[model samples]
Target: MDPGANWWEALSAIGTVLAVLVSVAVAIREVARARAAESALEDERRQRLAEQRRGIAALVTAWAESQYEPSPDGTHYVRRVIAHVANESTEPAFNLNVVLAYGSPLIQLGPLSIPVPIHVLPARQARSWDVSPGFAAHSTGVGQVPTDPIASISFEDSRGVAWTRGYDGKLQEGGGHQAISPDSETGEAQIGPLDSPFNPIAVVTAFHSALESATTVQDLKPLLSPTATGWSALTNEELVALRDEHAAYGLAAHVWYPTPRIAYVRLIHDDDIERARKGDSARALVVTLVFLVGKGWRVFSSGGAVTEPDWIKFPRKDLLRDLRG
Candidate 1:
């Protein structure tokens, strides 16, 4: 073979090797570019999911606070909540669990420090988990865990009157007066004539009679003493308004006049009050009798009004005095 031909052959082989190397390099670059795009998409997806989770957390917090109210048994206030979790990945999450930390009023369950078992629904379906009737003693935190490993973790505080987390966590208050009880007679005596047989049962009966007799506001006027400042405060228009409002709301009076001095009656305007004492916004129209030097036990006062001290900013006793004057 000619030397020149051999040299040309060697050059052709080198050119072919170089073309192969160039092709391999191009393929590697394409793979790298695809991988980079995929990574960016994953990051974007994660960010969106995090944002959605945050929004859900906010909504859950609001729902919880709205439901929180004083228990009617007057023992405590309760807040209950349900949260929805979504599966963001293509693979189904298996045995998914949540870790909950109870900080202050929120106490953690022992051993696992894990959240209560939450039912796993389908990818788009939702599941619910109850956080409490949790007491006002502690704060709450929750974290989500998926069986398959992923890079995102977030947590939120579940305590506060409003939907934000931080030092604002306060104990929810009971609605009824702490001084009064369903069966309590002593506290009932303080408001009315102690010597009169105006206990809860008696007062309820008297109010019922008054309500039955009340064809007009004027007829009901006789049940209240002439000296009663509360009744006097009501204008004729206001009285008519009360009657109308009460009638619309199904207001009914029950008196428990056990003794002349102590009386207890519930003026139920709606069924809401029985569900929660906080709904007892309707005036109870209590009548208390106090003894005087010249007079024996008589109706000390009528149309009694009681409000939750926390909600009522003004001093009720002072207001009462001003009305009397």
Candidate 2:
């Protein structure tokens, strides 16, 4: 073959390879552009979904407020913390729960968590629930500083999707579990009185009725522990007098269980402890009932007089310390 003919053929082959390379480069660019578009569309879809989820959860909101006010029973003034929940949307919120908590690094008498369940909250309305029962009234000896509490709320939207708004007020889906009624002092879970004999109020009521008929020290001894100071101090004559007094007064008892095993009771004529705070002219009987493992409930400590408003101690330091653990 001639040299020029060979050179022309070589040049044609190089042009063919260049054309193929260009075609491949164009294809790769087009594929990359398509993938980029798909990725962007996916990101936008996710963003929309997130916004929709947040909108559904944000319909309801909750906050906490604390104030010094009359207790629920109208006995005395207490520093009370209440949770306020509002459904701002036109639709009703279901399974609404408000929780006021002191999270982590427990403060004095803290690591406190109070949960109140409101089965349903009506549309465009608000509701309030007591998170703490007269903080000063219940927590008598506990340090009262750092009383500010954070609140979290959980509720179900109209679509039956569960959501939680945390302390930061950020909305998230799928709350772990609902909090039912909780103990006031210990924040332990308790269903209402189930008619069991172990119910604290029932046991105290029965004990009160039994004490009213006791005629002698021997009769009273069974009602109170031998180690109780009140038991040691009561004379036979005093016991008879007390029985007669109980018969005449028929005092009502307000019981608080600091722990399952311990009860602090306020024996009052009515809900009014104000009468008792007035220099013993009319005073309330403050007693402690301890549940002995096999023996049931007995008056562990008695004859404590609440002659002053500050003197009424329900959740004492020792009990709170025990609760902290």
Candidate 3:
């Protein structure tokens, strides 16, 4: 064979070997890339889980600090959290279940025999969640919304007392009334009382009566003497705004009265110092007062009314005489 031919053959073999080496190198690089991607995905998953645990821990701490205790079954507790969601959402956007679970430390949702699984779904906005009923034998008292825009949701037990979950995963009485009736002029209808020691139904009745006689703010002023603090605290601008708002709605108070028998008052009682410091301490007596002019019944005031007479200074002993007809 010619020496040039032999040299060409040797070069061809070397070229083939180089091509094989290059292919193997390319395969190894691809494998390494795939492994790296898998590792990154795992790291991300672990990070998400850690964040979730941290969130759960924070919620539990808040509940515990509020003095909430786990249920006898060791899995359930009641606490109040802001139900953050649009009024029209189909599902709750809060993760109350996880919060409850972590906060209660050992409470289980199953033994509670709730009909639906309490779920808190993520809201459209960050840092908010929707609350609602979850899987259990009965409704969890989380998702129900009131029909009226001004009305708030409340829960009632078989004994007719209203109930609500506190921030610490414990059940407590709610501040609002379950029902209100406004139409009866005789003040015999059932309604929740306002927060003051004064009866809400009575205030409403008096206000309604005074409003019927009032042609201006001056006329309305005397009727509101029972809730003088509420009125006095209002700025002139605020009163003007209120008047304008009422005028736009063609609203005016005529006669207001509370149902003497059905109105009940609730007092707040909790030993949690943090809750009180957080302004969570609240006592309310519910009374339904009907306003004749509005042809509606309102849950008078969640906060009770206080009497502040401008010119009269009567001792507590003579107060009854002064108010007596």
Please give the CA lDDT of all the candidate structures.
Answer: 0.36, 0.56, 0.32
Worst 10 residues of 2 by lDDT: 106-115
Say which candidate scores most in lDDT. Answer: 2
| Poorest 10 consecutive residues by lDDT, candidate 3 | 130-139
- Which model scores highest in TM-score? 2
Q: What is the lDDT of residue 243 in candidate 2?
A: 63
Candidate order by lDDT, decreasing, is 2, 1, 3
**Candidate 1 local distance difference test against the native:** 0.36
Tell me the deviation in Å of residue 244 in model 1: 57
In candidate 3, position 301 carries an lDDT of: 29
Show where candidate 3 strays beyond 4 Å.
1-209, 215-223, 226-245, 249-325
Clashes (backbone N, CA, C under 3 Å), per candidate, total 42, 0, 55
Give the Å shift of residue 177 in candidate 3. 23
lDDT, candidate 3, residue 127? Answer: 27
TM-score (C-alpha, index-matched) for candidate 1 = 0.25
